[model samples]
Target: MQKIDYREWGVDTLFYWKLLIGLGIIVALGGLSALYMEHEGHWVTGMTNLVVWGTPHMFAVFLVVAASGALNIASIGSVFGKKEYKPLARLSGLLAITLLVGGLLVLVLDLGRPDRLLVALFNNNFKSIFAWNIYLYSGFMVIVAAYLFTMMERKANFISRPVGILAFTWRLILTTGTGSIFGFMVSRQAFDSAILAPMFIVMSFAYGLAIYLLVLMFTFAQDNRVIGDNLIKRLKNLLGLFILGMLFFTAVYHLTKLYGTKYHGVEYFFLVDGGIYTLTFWLGHILVGMLLPLALMFCPRFSPSRMALAIACGLVVIGGLATMYTIIIGGQVYQLEMFPGMTVINEGYGTEVAKYAKYCPTVPEFLLGIGGMGVALLATTIGIRVLKFLPETLADESVS
Candidate 1:
């Protein structure tokens, strides 16, 4: 067996420092946005009583879900014993931790009362999916941290397999819990489906892998490291498979809902009459996010090009945000069927629930979301720089 080599990123300090400064600016803007929302209240943004989740939730959920998926690379190496994937394991673990942290930061800050996080920590409501996630999120951080330790520390190398297995199992449960957050909401027409749980698991796989690919490629390129075509091909193919799986679940979800007369109205809203939401689903989520990327990846002409593969991964990331936006915002905007078979009439003074709730995210909300990405990238870059997370070379010969 060829020995593997791992090393910290020892790239140009000028570029490294510039990257950190740019990310710091983003983080700072995100903090300012949070402060603005906290002081002025959610009213300053697009959120109303009808649409509570808003753009921040969209970004937060995407980051959180993607975080679980990012760990898939490491899981493939350590748990599944895929030797080709082993060299990437350390960076994978780091991305998982940083992504989750970035996500949770947005989630907590968007609460409007960030201090109440302390209350959530002390309070236990096992019945609530939200509460269950508290433990899942915290435990995920701890477990992945240990998993990284096992891989990085020579003394703990013997137990890497057991810890890797544990981390893998925990992430699955964590994602299941995340999906359940929406699925368990029986009152919401858009969310009340068992398919969402597994669908989300698949989404994490796709989104996480896409982000991982982009990061891997970009970092490798930045350092002039030899990331050969073979490794890129393997990762891209995996990404394509995951995207296909997610699409399948998506079809089943909507099809199952369409099968029932009870859900027909909501289905129409999402698929047709919801205007922007429908367009977002078709254009942003399906066509751009899934189809175009799929073509770039699977087509004989495009698939072989390194630039094409990178573009596919980038498109997947964009499509993921669009998917979340449609799910989080579009789901909330649709009027709920609180009283079936009865029409609701407006009596003025906020008494009547409009047919569709309105939401237009403010600048601050966008900044906050962008900030989360900034945090994730910043942390990831720092991790690679300070520690031996990246393999020295991912050339065909070395990785094989």
Candidate 2:
């Protein structure tokens, strides 16, 4: 067997360097936004007592889920024994770390007291899912890094399969944990479901692949490298399949909710009458996010065009965000059913059972979320330039 030659991106063009610098500035802006929010407190943002987790959580969770999903390429090679995907493993591992770091950073910085991160880490509660997530997230970093080492270090290659399997299993548990965070919320009519664990897993597949394809395309385009049509076709087909799975879960989720007479009101609120929430769910997630992307990728005319694939990938990402917004923010906006039938009101929340709270995201919150993306991109950009993360070429002849 011939060993694959790993090479740095080695992009020395002025344009390449400028792009990295520009992304760095964006990261800096995001940091400044975080500082402002921390100084003024959570009150400065759109978050209120009623809607505690807002836009930042949406973005953070997306990045986190996508991060694990991004490992599909590596998992395909190591766990599933797909030889074609083996070359992409290093970049896959790299993305998992950087994207998760970006996500966890946004989540951590959103804390009213960002300084208390150590306390959050040290003060562990085994009963709390969030506490388990902290360990999962931290452990993921260590284990995945070791997994990457098994790929990077030739002598350690013997352990790659075992480490890969471990990493793959760990991410499943991590994503399931993340999903249960919402699924376990029995008080909220929107969340309480056993289906969410597998649903999130499927979602991670679509969102992760979309982001991976985006990054793969962009990076390859940047270096003027050729990606094999065969490989990309497989990726696009996989993406389409995962998306269909997402739609299946989305449908089943609503169908299951619609089945219960009590859940009808909650379903109506999100599906028909929640105004922006309804539009976002139907138009943004279902129409633009799912349908349009599927059309772009599967359509005979445009499917062959790389640009069409890119657009589909971009739309999928937008849809993923829209879905999260509906799930996280919109879910919170609707009042939790403390008393199922009675219209209970409290001093803390002066509203009826069906009343929805208003929460508009502030600029700082947006930047903070974007900064997490910056952190991910910045890490990837720097890592590729410095290390042998990218293959010299992915042309069928070269890779084969």
- In order of listing, the candidates' clash counts read 0, 0
TM-score for model 2? 0.96
lDDT of 1 by residue, 215-301 (tens): 898888898998878888889889999999988998999999999999988899999999899988998889988999999999999
RMSD of 2: 1.7
- Would you give me the overall lDDT of model 2? 0.89
User: How close to the true structure is residue 331 of candidate 1, measured as C-alpha lDDT?
Assistant: 92
Instruction: State how far residue 378 of model 2 sits from its true place (Å).
Output: 0.6
Report the error of model 2 at residue 358, Å: 0.9
lDDT tens digits, residues 1-400, model 2? 2356778776667977798888988889889989999888888899998899999998899999999999878999999998888999999999999999999999999988889889987898988989999999999989989999999998999999999999999999999999999999888888999898888898899988899899989988978888999889999999999999999999999999999998887899899989889988999889978999999998999999999999999999899989989998888888777777776555364454336778899999999998999999999988888888888778876665
